[model samples]
Target: MSSLRSSELDGDSDDSQLAAKFWEVKLPDVVPLDDLKAIEKTQAAEVIQRAWFSHMDKIIFQLLKHTICAAENCVTHEILKKVCPSEAALVKDPSVQCKVRFRFGGKNFPPFIVFKIFLHTGGHGNKYFSGKNTLRPSSEAVVDACKLMGNRKYYDQIIQDQLQFQKYKVADEVDVVTMKDYMHFTSFLDETPAYLGGKSNCWRRLSLENFPKTMIMYDIMDYATSGTLSDRLQKELKYLLQKPKSKEMHHDQLRIVSQVRHWG
Candidate 1:
C-alpha cells in the first residue's frame, strides 16, 4: 500500500487514513491570501466549512469569465496573462514560459500544459530558463539545432523569448492539471455524482477567496509554466481504486456480455 506523507495536507493532525486522495491534487505553492477572509458568513459555528462556503460564493462573483475575458483583453489591446480562453489571452505571467507537451496517445493528448508568457524574464519568471526538471536533453538539442540552422528568429522568438518548448512527458510522469482546480470534488463522500460529471462546472468555481486552490484558467497556466511534475509513480489511472469501494477486479469498461452487478 502507498504510505501517506506529510505532503498530503489532509487537514488531519493525526495519521490514520491516507491524506493524498485520488481526486485531491496538491496545487502549486502560490502566495497565500494576505489578511483575506470570506466576504460573508453563515449562522453556523465559525467552522472551516462555513468559512469555505462564504468565501467561494463571493469569489465566484468576480470570476465570471464573461466579465473579465470578454471585456479587458478586448478593450485594452493588451493580453492580460490572467484569465484566458473564451477568445481571450493564452498565458499571461507563467513560471515556465514554454508550453510543455506530453504524449499519452493521439490528438486527444495535445500539449497538455501550456505555460503562460511572462512580460519579462526576471525574478520568479526565470523558472523557464532555470529549475529542476527544466533541464532535459531534448530542450538543449532544440536550442542548439536552432542555433546551427541559423534560425535565430524562431530560436530567439519562441525559445529564448517566449520560453516555449514541447518536451516529451507522460501523464504519470508530469502533473496532469485541469484548466482550473475544482475544489468541490467529493470522491469518497460523493461517488454517483463523481462519475456523472453532472455538476462539474458547479463544483468547479474560480473562487480563491477562501479556497486558494480554486484557480482561474490564467492561474492554472501560470503553474503549468513554473511547476514540475512529481517523480512519485503510481498505478495506471484506469486500474486505480474506484468508488463504491471495490475490492474484486472487474472489466475496465462495460458493454453487452456481462450482466450488470450494480444497476441503478
Candidate 2:
C-alpha cells in the first residue's frame, strides 16, 4: 500500500512539472540605457537613433542565443522544443506548411543555413568591424564588417567540402559513378543544422562512386548558397551551361578561385 501511494504521488508531481514547463514564465527585462543616459528628445535623429539601437540590441540577443545553442550538446530540433514547445502545434497546421514553402521558395531550406548564420555571427571580438584608418570612415568598412559577421568560417568549410566533392566527380570521369557520395554529403547538410556541428569529417569521403546527379545537384546547390566559392561557382556553372561562354566568366572564375586560394 505504501509503494502504491508513493507511485501515485510521483505521477502527480510529474504532471505538475509538465504543466509548469508548458506555460510562459516572466523575468525582469533590463534597460541598457538608463534615464539620464537616454537620448534627448530634442537631439537630432533622436527617434531614429533610439530605433536603430533597439534593433542592434535585438540582433545582439539573437546572436547570443544562437551562440549559446551552438555551444550546447543538444540538436537543433531539441533546442527549438525547449525554447517554444507550443510551436509543436504548428507542425499539423496547413498554414504553417504554406508559410514554410513560401519562405524556402516552394521547397524547404535545410536548417543548416540558420546554423551557419548563427555560428558566423557569434564569433567573438570586433575583427569584422574595425574602422578604416580612424578619421572620416568609409561606408565600405561598416558594410564589410556586417558581411564578415556572417561570411567567415562557414564559407571556408563549405568551399573545402565542395572542392573535395568535385575532385571525386573529376576522378570518376563518368557523371554517374563519380558522384555517388554527393548525396550523403549534401544530405548531411540538409538533415542537420550546421550549428549543431553536423558537418562531420566523414563528409570529405563523398565521391563519384557513391552518388548520382540528383545528389550532385543537392551538394552544388548548398555550396552555391554558402558564399564560399559562390561567385566563382556561379561563373563556372554559367560558362559550362552556356554555349560559347563569355571570356569574362572565365576570367572571373579564375579571379575568384585565386582570391580564395590566397585567403587560405
Predicted structure with the largest lDDT when compared to the true one: 2
Global lDDT scores for all candidate models: 0.29, 0.38
Kindly list the per-residue Cα lDDT of model 2 for residues 1-264, writing each as its tens digit.
Answer: 999999999999999999999895887776566643554544647778989967644533332233223223223233334334454344334444311110112233222222211212234422211131121325666456557656775466446546644654421112333345545534443343334223321211112222122222222333433423344334445433333267665444333222322211
User: How many pairs of residues in model 1 come into backbone collision?
Assistant: 5
Worst 10 residues of 2 by lDDT: 97-106
Q: CA RMSD for every model? A: 29.1, 30.0
For candidate 2, the per-residue lDDT at 148 reads 69
Model 1 segments beyond 4 Å from truth? 1-43, 47-58, 61-67, 71-73, 79-264
Query: Whole-model lDDT for model 1 versus the true structure?
Result: 0.29
How accurate locally is residue 110 in candidate 1, as Cα lDDT from 0 to 100? 17
* TM-score per model over all chains: 0.16, 0.17
Candidate 2 at 187: error in angstroms? 2.6
